[model samples]
Target: MDSGDILASLGVNGAAAAAHALSLPAEAYGNDAQLEVLWAMKAYNHAEVYFNLISSVEPTFLKLTKSDDMIYSKFREDFPDMDIKTLDPELLKSADAKEKWRPFCNQFEGIVEDFNYGTLLRLDCQKDYTEENTIFATRIQFFAIEIARNREGYNDVVHSARAKAKQQQDQC
Candidate 1:
């Protein structure tokens, strides 16, 4: 199966798991930590699906370019166990994955710049409070992954050109 199919399957499984976890009795719902874990899993699953759908496409590309029947079929098959009734049709329609992803990329760029600011502040601070700086640190960590992924696209282009040049050199 393609990456999209794999991601869709994972998303479906994640939704099912989250629903099952949520169905537990109030007392059985456990603590905030458990809830956080469930939410995190859901977030990861959604992100994987979104990224798989959009990552390779050009900027400003629209998911609507794909057939609606196909998109709906994938969504239904992947999330069969979930309560999709609450899903926003408008949001889904507007979620042209490629175009929407630009904001995420921009956020990632901003976070990296913010990290540079943090580094400057850290140098001026008398005592280390790295552990206490969870918010900014977490932002940095997450954005770093985004930045790396973004860089990978550019690297692929450059690498392809280098390979082509090397091939020509070898021919000479």
Candidate 2:
């Protein structure tokens, strides 16, 4: 009688298909921009897993990590008029940050088009993922900050957590 029963009656794998299908926003049902963001988020999520794993094992990766924008400096040597300062900061938020960010985003328009900007996602803060301390960030901003965080050692706390977890499991 309800949506679940209707789905079942229609012979859809109600539980399995419903789990993924109904979870999307009505706007995201077919919007290419939303779909691309979702797909990019999936790849970014996988990259985060590997980023955490590799940085945990070798802190040097954390020591050496750099945002995509950071490579701009090297490019400047060949193109003298190319100012690397035009790149966005590693962490971005607030209206002013967005205003200052237009040029950088323009350069990557093919890749970062949606700039829709209002959406929020629950995520692990580099130090702690507590709801109280958590901050909401836009999708593109997340890419910038995370790249900087991993490089700047903001994720070093994860190593300690992993160590503590291993010790507990070993004792068990």
Candidate 3:
């Protein structure tokens, strides 16, 4: 039977669970191409949901994980002058960026689950997720950048804009 048939037999909820489970690579999986694509799509949707959440609320008060304060502190210490609000995509994907980020990411090796898992991150806090605005990075890196962006008030505009839109909708 085809893979589609197998998935179809599982039903919609089962298929969704399967996709989420396959999104993270395991030792036994051994880098399957299909699994990688599934992971990418799941990561993209995760990012989209995160962006929507932050835009609708005050990002500064949101705690993504239990270690929010610790993550933000380390990020600030490691990247003192880095302007995450205006972060450039090329800079984030550059070899230099990886080299610099490795040490920061490594600090949370045991503390953060799936710290090295691939994830999608937005280049600018002011922009919505789009093909041109997103980049691939490790989960820890995404959290660090986003935590810093939130704490630094870069994401405040999203909340204000969303509130304005809601107010207009309510009036109409």
Candidate 4:
């Protein structure tokens, strides 16, 4: 796919918007086609790893970053009303959420790698990654939502459901 298609598929409207989402210069995008491909690859790899992780084991036992406790506490404090098990992309992408998330994201600058970099976030905890079910979010935002999902038992439910489905398939 061309860059425009790729950007659209990733939920980015344009190079300018994609750059803004990633907190990078707009010029940094169109000038390097290879860079965009690399970014797509990285996103796909991350999605694959996370899908496998949640499917294979209990996500609550998984630690996303070294500062899991601190991050989880802050996430809960900042988003007390967030229904992590049924996370809505519209709510997360809203102006209010963005305004609140900036500071929360900035606080983990050094603790998380590429903390502000754009990443693909699954909108629903019970579903695997899919174009319609994904949205672009900062890495820290992904961590916060996912950490909440894991801790709240949504991901464990996903794991159990997938396992049961696989067992049924084997029996069939």
Query: Pick by lDDT: which candidate is best?
Result: 3
List model 2 lDDT by residue over 49-140, tens digit each.
64566435643254222335552332233233422222222334557755755555455444543333433322443443344433444444
Clashing pairs in 3: none
Model 4, span 62-169: residue lDDT tens: 998998888899999988888877677766778987888889999998888888877788877778789888888888888888988888887897789879999999
Clashing pairs in 2: none
lDDT of 1 at 63: 32
The reply for model 4, stretches above 4 Å from the true place, is: 1-31, 169-172
Whichever of 2 and 3 has more lDDT, that candidate is 3
- Candidate 2 — which residues are off by over 4 angstroms? 1-92, 112-126
Question: Backbone clashes per model, in order?
Answer: 0, 0, 0, 0
Per-prediction TM-score to the true structure, in the order listed:
0.25, 0.45, 0.84, 0.78
Q: Rate the local accuracy (lDDT) of all candidates.
A: 0.37, 0.46, 0.83, 0.80
| Candidate 1 accuracy as TM-score | 0.25
Candidates sorted by TM-score, best first: 3, 4, 2, 1
Please provide, for model 3 over 134-172, each residue's C-alpha lDDT reduced to its tens digit, 9 standing for 90 to 100: 888889989999988888899998888899999999999
For model 3 the local lDDT of residue 136 reads: 87
Q: How many backbone clashes does candidate 1 have?
A: 0
Model 1: per-residue lDDT, tens digit, 34-67?
Answer: 5655544444444444344333443123233223
True lDDT of residue 147, candidate 2: 45
lDDT of 3: 0.83
Q: Give the TM-score of candidate 3.
A: 0.84
Worst 10 residues of 3 by lDDT: 1-10
